[model samples]
Target chain A: MKKNPQTAACLLIGDELLSGRTRDANANTLAKALYAKGIELIEVRIVPDEHKTIGNALIDLKVKADIVITSGGIGPTHDDITADAVSAALGRKTVEHDGAMKILKAHYAAKDEEVTDARRRMARMPKDAELIANSVSGAPGFRVENVYVLAGVPAIFDAMLEEVLAAVPDGEPETVYHVTGEAKESDLADGLRDLETALKGLKIGSYPGPTGKGGPLTIVCRSRSASVCEQAALAVKALFTAQGKEAEIGQGDRPA
Target chain B: MKKNPQTAACLLIGDELLSGRTRDANANTLAKALYAKGIELIEVRIVPDEHKTIGNALIDLKVKADIVITSGGIGPTHDDITADAVSAALGRKTVEHDGAMKILKAHYAAKDEEVTDARRRMARMPKDAELIANSVSGAPGFRVENVYVLAGVPAIFDAMLEEVLAAVPDGEPETVYHVTGEAKESDLADGLRDLETALKGLKIGSYPGPTGKGGPLTIVCRSRSASVCEQAALAVKALFTAQGKEAEIGQGDRPA
Candidate 1:
């Protein structure tokens, strides 16, 4: 596992998403998974299913991040051209991988169905790409260089991500601490800025929930050093206390 | 109102979104609103709260699309550097808008709360930027050139978008038709390809829903011309019928 914090980008390809017909869940799922493994998801792009668009985005994102994970456009349809786009981006020929073919064949054979040409299309991959196991569905995702092309379906995408994450080396996970208070963000903004400046490399964020919520202002402090994160969390709590407000630490399940 | 289809992009800036701590609803809400106004949301980018990242992304997205809408990072916090980034991107100085200051002062005064400096920070906007009305919240979003900077909160973002959309010119709205069936996408892949080729300027997409759903396969046809979209939709339904599968038209409310 790599100790350094690695950067990741998510490329979501689907016309439905841009059309406002579908809200994407894959990016959020992938982001959380990558964060747990100490990888920072720096960028997320949602592009249409056009070949040129997907191919261009893949090329651009690969240059910007250490790893790029793409979801969608890997189905058995004409618009499902993610494989071809990836091949184009990598300057590799799209070919039927023997391992991917066997997986699809076995899955279909067990169901008493023939492997049709359209179904076989799912087996095609960029040359030199390695297959990523898809336990939930028959069609497997593939990795070419730092780009991992996964399924669009949320269930299958999540399942395949588990395997992908297991294979990838872990990076330096960030230690995070959450503090919630009744004070408005504006009331503590200056103090938060001072704390952030005093503690270098400490990232703090303030999220204000709706009024009447037990603690409307939730502050998140994250750093590679757990001690630094803990220290910053205390400082945040002190700011709320100075405002005559009660601050609770570690009450929220997620970061702000 | 512009008669031709206008391309738009959304730039969402926040660490919480990338951390999976906050699932973005602003982009989806903006996308849907823009679609109704005949604008095509071609790209959506979620970047971190870093100044350079946000500034660079804003410059890039503005070049590609006719309009760019950014949500998040416009709050009173250390991480809320979106205004500064936007100012840098456009090479404009940040200044307090008199109108925005009045709105913030009135809102806070009505609540019998003192207007703090951190709260006043929300009044800052890029030079030459016009304020967008925020009926839900006092802090107004600002428009600079083709870029519109909006709040991150879902309710506030949605409300501001309504005003922004109303001010922008309407484009040529695409007419969409949906057809869903039980047939597998692969079974109709070849037919879809043929239909796509036959209908120029028509965009078609295939989305497969989860199993056990009555109509798992949905076909979406979209075009500026209603007649053309309707014609392509019928072709899709005919393909499903040829496969001896029942194709239901308009069973779903949204496009596939």
Candidate 2:
């Protein structure tokens, strides 16, 4: 039976991200979270804090993937247009959600301060949207349809992602087995291609050394079935062993 | 006269990226390079190493932006489908470029190795493709029309980016001035909203404290014109002065 895996797309909204003022750590976090949850993060897009840009990208991703998660542009500022854009994209009215209002009011009330119009903007969401709790901050992320809007800051995004991921169902997680060897990527390519064609469903990746010295290749084998991954990895290791090259097996072999 | 700035988009390709096995640094590098070159990075997309997905996203981005740059999946491996996908997307036939083959041969020849079929795959590019020199690696990146393909590795990507960026003309760089103060984002919202409307084209961003403490807000003002940015920054700093809160002027206030 061909099992259809759940797929997700991330729409990261902010001008700073596009302008290189901010380096985004949210995509990796979301990708790892979704991977652990067995949801395929098929695509990720970083757009500016523009209304039409966010709305267009959100609408596109929501239609393409089962779940669409957005980060950034939801803060309390004129550039915080995610709430409005999301509302328009999902065909819902933007309103001051009572639950959000209550949370913000209490969060500010704790410090003996009143919720300002700017802070209250965090409470604005699509009508009938469900709130995703932010343990780090009082400003709650909201869910409209299949799209989840979360805070842009890494700390807040990470905290809110845990809550939103709770609703996601688990599946057969992809198994990745990396085999590092002191061999040229080209030397292993022929063997890898032969096995890659025979393996059918496994993905084989060959990455060269970081310094581009042509040695210290890392072969990554991935499959939904752990057995297939093991088989592919062993075959890759054997290729190295055959060439009298030292090889070691590990879980992940990606550069930081 | 309203200046229409040159815009670029990035398409990061690799299955490891989507699987959360690798954290991407290419987007930020590309963003910063484009920013310094006075070009606007309008959007960035990270897609898995799939032919159709890469092709579709490439076609879309190449049409929308003045330039489209792709990183990763052009290695000598079964999963390296970037070159073929880009070729198909640009309606060109994939062929072994003489220049790429020459480079690959000389690179391997220096190491006392012959260019194998797997190694030769790196030389495949769209017919009539222009080469982007990778100073660190033997495999040269290719350009098909407005699209520039580069290596996924940071050192190589950074090096190749410098070469690609050279061909792009300088534009009116966006001006960004940040004022950080110990004030609630909500408290400043009313005043900010007033100036935001009056400033017309300036983009104002309010970032709460990293710890979500509700105080210590950072107000970011941006415009294509530096004078407008100065005017907005002065007004924002004045707001902090009026509230007797210490505000510091800086260049960037984004979280890493």
Candidate 3:
């Protein structure tokens, strides 16, 4: 098993999600991205737009995880109190940031629309916080004491993550291999065990996804070590092919 | 602050989610449900179909959260190891439960298929575990100790959760109200302060969502008490409308 790396916790805020009205895709993406970056995503908490609940969750994660990233409550809507709650958690007054306000003013003005005080609320930040860049939207996210606040919209979240991830220290990048053709997963179970034993540090997992044609298994091999992951994957491929199972090696790409 | 409730955490397992193939809708739904049930969802961890990662996350959540629910990684596929990892966490050997086997046999027989050994794996559970009824799928979920293992598919997960929730104790139920047509959030700032001050146990949140015509502002009020929540919402409505702002009631039920 890989020793715990730098860990992170995520807090998702919204009511639409709780009512099963909207599905969330961010947690899964963030988890995969963090895993490849060698950051252990230890926990995720989803609370509604309740100030006390959000405040408590923030305080708790700050004590537990090395970093915390929050999404959803940063919007210009009335329910967006993630920033306020984060401020409460840090015992800092939520104040309008000049830079953020400037950006929002420019954005609203560029679109030739009035920047209502409600819209201006998007520019608020915790005391002495750095701004997280939002490439998808002009409304920037903020960071305070290791907590990165981001917008809930998927496009903005994905774009902001590129910058957020750049700031996070990398541990080990994960690798992957695709194996397919005429093999039941159990057929390779013994070989997988052998590989797991041979490469103790590397973690190998198989996924049987529906190939475009049909159900052909995609054996995914992952590890913190690039070399170890590749070696194990190749060994598995060689063994499976020799045993008359059609298996193929996939190109390695670190999860974003 | 409601003084921390019983801690709860979730473990989401599946390569479908990791690969961005299946957009996860369950995490938020469960988080909200758990929160309403009075379990403070402390953390949610997503792991692929790797034993070590799943096992580690399971152990971690078990120790951290008072109750833990895991979804996905319970299937006939070789990639599924939630049962094994769960067993490992409980320090119990995985054994095929006779009742589960019987259920699985009946399910497969209904579909006119032979129960393969791989299919039999779905019947495996840790010693002395109770089953979470799955009306959506024949493959059932399990609950043991503080952990409630559930299916990955959204429909099945929802069905199982209905039963699981009934068996579990209900937390304090929260009341929600909608206050709409507020001219500005700042207009209600003073009123919000007074209401929050008066309703000590209640939480007053203001959210201005996009009304259908993109003209009116909505103020949402939430509290554990129905009367308090209604009173707060009424106070905000009267205060805002007095200032020539359109103020009507809204809900935490729908996005403000």
The regions of model 1 sitting more than 4 angstroms off are A1-5, A210-215, A251-256, B1-5, B210-215, B251-256
lDDT of 1 at B81: 92
Say what the interface RMSD of candidate 1 is: 2.5
Say what the RMSD of model 2 is. 2.9
Model 1: lDDT equals 0.86
Measured against the native two-chain assembly using Cα atoms, what DockQ does each of the candidate structures obtain, in the order listed?
0.61, 0.67, 0.18
Interface RMSD of each: 2.5, 1.9, 6.4
The docking quality of candidate 1, as DockQ, is: 0.61
Candidate 2 chain B worst ten-residue window by lDDT: B247-256
Q: Pick the candidate with the highest TM-score.
A: 1
- Could you tell which candidate, 1 or 3, scores higher by lDDT? 1
The number of the candidate with the highest lDDT is: 1
- Candidate 1 chain B lowest-lDDT run of ten: B208-217
Model 1 chain A weakest 10-residue run by lDDT: A208-217
lDDT of 2 by residue, A1-256 (tens): 0134399999999887887877889999999988887788989999988888899999899889988899987878777899999998878899999999999999889978778778888999999999999888689999888888999988999999999877666766778888987887777888998998999788888777666655678888878888888999899999999889989887754422
Compose the digit string of candidate 3's lDDT tens values, residues A1-256: 1133387778877765554335676776787788778676766666667799789878877787788888888866556789889998899998989999888788769878667766788888998889988755578998898788987767778778888888777875556655555565545666776777788676666544332122565566767677887888788787678668766677652122
Docking class of 3: incorrect
